[model samples]
Target: MTTKKPVVVELYDEIVFPDPSEAFLSRVQGHPAVNLPRLPAGVTLPPPIPVEDASKRRKGDTKDHSLTQWFTNFSEADELLQLAAARQRVQAHIAKLRRQISLIDGQQQQFKSTPEQ
Candidate 1:
């Protein structure tokens, strides 16, 4: 005896694939799939700024004008200046060492000319 099993079927909404000619026609007709939101008149985001203004707020009457209200504490600047000075000193020391090496090389050359008995 042969038994027949019923076929299971799944149905879905009809999806139309766009024709190449239709796509070109829609593109030529100025149909955009996604549109950008428009901002209201006279509204804008604030301008960018640097890190030095961390402790202050924007000031002055002009639209983009700004100022630093508080003077930076001297200790921080002094420390930075000291660091720069130390770097300069180290560079000078390296230059002096190079000069000393050149002098030693010259002296060795001079001693090389003297004959040993």
Candidate 2:
């Protein structure tokens, strides 16, 4: 008797994925609002002014740079320091107010308990 060998079959040989670039292009092309510039009505853009002098231009380094970069380099330690300082000040104020209220309540109770002189 002759031994028979079974043939192996491959599946998904014809399966192909679509190109990402082509898919993106197709999506943008299909969308109607992809290329339109969105702006409110009655807002006319001013004409471009040529900057002829660099010497006369006001520098924003001292003002804008400080504001924009104020917290850029901040660390958790710095935040905790500020938070602790604020908490201490607030807690002190609250303690003072509470003491004042307690004194007022004590005075009121004393006035009520004292007989008319």
Candidate 3:
């Protein structure tokens, strides 16, 4: 009786396998600037990052709302500025009327009251 040999398969042309060596593993660990947490005495380290894939992003699965960016453009910016200017003008006019009323009240009080002598 003879033992059977294992078969090898290539999944994709772009996918590159790492060299199963301590130097390669250490190089992969140091590739990123991140400092990985220390493992427990009996715990084993997680596998290295898979860079062979076209994109490592899992965020594409979520639905994106464009309204946030769209609304922030401030399409009615000019109209808003015009409204603000009108409000300021109205406030200034009200302040001027209040000052005139106070001045008139002061003059009327002075004329209405005569000297005791």
Candidate 4:
């Protein structure tokens, strides 16, 4: 018989994670300089996902929403701002990677079309 261990989710200050390691906790705790942008007038935010509800989701269920889904309420303003900043940083990195890939592709095509020595 196999025994299933209970999932241990901990919330330290505002960071929530299941079974966190020391390294993970160290990296994420307390970055105080984050500035959360105020929601513009007439903007409709998506409903926030409760931490309990999120923990109950199946492994593949998480991919259906944005990173902001968990912090989409007025109550979670700081978290929402932190998530938004992270999203912006990631998008910038992705754009840089895409540009590098395009440059590499162009070089490959040019090399293929050149006359053999």
Candidate 5:
């Protein structure tokens, strides 16, 4: 029988809002003085710039081989790199511990086999 790996799925939505200044203008320019409805709790408003415009601006401003830009702009990449390094370190430590445990077990077996002098 073959075991199948589980598939993981993630969903994300991107929202873009005009800058605060623009929102402010919209609020102030409203001809009616009716009280505006409140937004849902924990719901955040997006910035004024459109998502496409923001992406274009980021691409234009960043250059290849820029460490700060890479670190700041690509958190998923940075996190993966960090996780890889951590896994390597953990594996190394586990191997060392295994060797130490084996050595201790061998010593214990040897001492047990030797008759009390």
Candidate 6:
């Protein structure tokens, strides 16, 4: 009797991986407010801007570069956003304090203008 050979069968041959060249690149996620400008290959990064000492700055003073245009990740963006919000809150609180002082000054002037018995 002749020995019979079993035929090998292949399943899911239609499944194929996408070509690397044709593949879509995922966008780098960052802060919503930040603009992510792509730099060309071999391009050198710009020099870092010098930051001033915090102790010398006046209270509630804001710096232009406090919120940077570029960020690496979500956490960095969140941190910068929090800093901005805190700065705004400080400014608002200062304004409120100034308004209170003005009101107190006005009341003092009213007392001064009144004739004493």
RMSD of each: 25.3, 23.1, 24.2, 18.2, 10.0, 25.2
State the displacement of the C-alpha of residue 33, model 5, in Å, after optimal TM-score superposition: 16
Per-model TM against the reference: 0.35, 0.39, 0.34, 0.37, 0.45, 0.36
The C-alpha local distance difference test score for the whole of candidate 2 amounts to 0.65
lDDT per residue (tens digit) for residues 1-117 in model 2: 445877779876543234458877788667987685655798555532344543354553233222333335544556778999999999999999999999999999999999998
**Can you tell me which runs of candidate 3 are displaced by over 4 Å?**
1-75
Worst 10 residues of 6 by lDDT: 20-29
Model 5 has an lDDT value of 0.68
Candidate 4's TM-score reads 0.37
Error in Å for residue 46 of model 4: 34
Provide the lowest-lDDT 10-residue window in model 2.
61-70
**Candidate 1's residue-wise lDDT over 32-96, tens digit each?**
66365566799664544554663364332233233222233334456768999999999999999
Top-TM-score candidate index: 5
Q: Residue 110 in candidate 6 has what lDDT?
A: 100
lDDT of 6: 0.63
Colliding pairs, model 4:
none
Error of 5 at 117 (Å): 3.0
lDDT of each: 0.64, 0.65, 0.65, 0.72, 0.68, 0.63
Clashing pairs in 2: none
Cα TM-score of candidate 3: 0.34
Candidate 5 C-alpha error for residue 80, in Å: 0.1
Which tens-of-lDDT digit does each residue in 78-114 have in candidate 3? 5668899999999999999999999999999998896
- Per-residue accuracy of model 5 over 1-117 as CA lDDT, tens digit each: 446876779998855344558767677658497466676899655534555655665343433323443245545556678999999999999999999999999999999999997
Which whole-number lDDT from 0 to 100 does residue 111 have in model 2?
97
lDDT tens digits, residues 82-117, model 4?
A: 899999999999999999999999999999999999
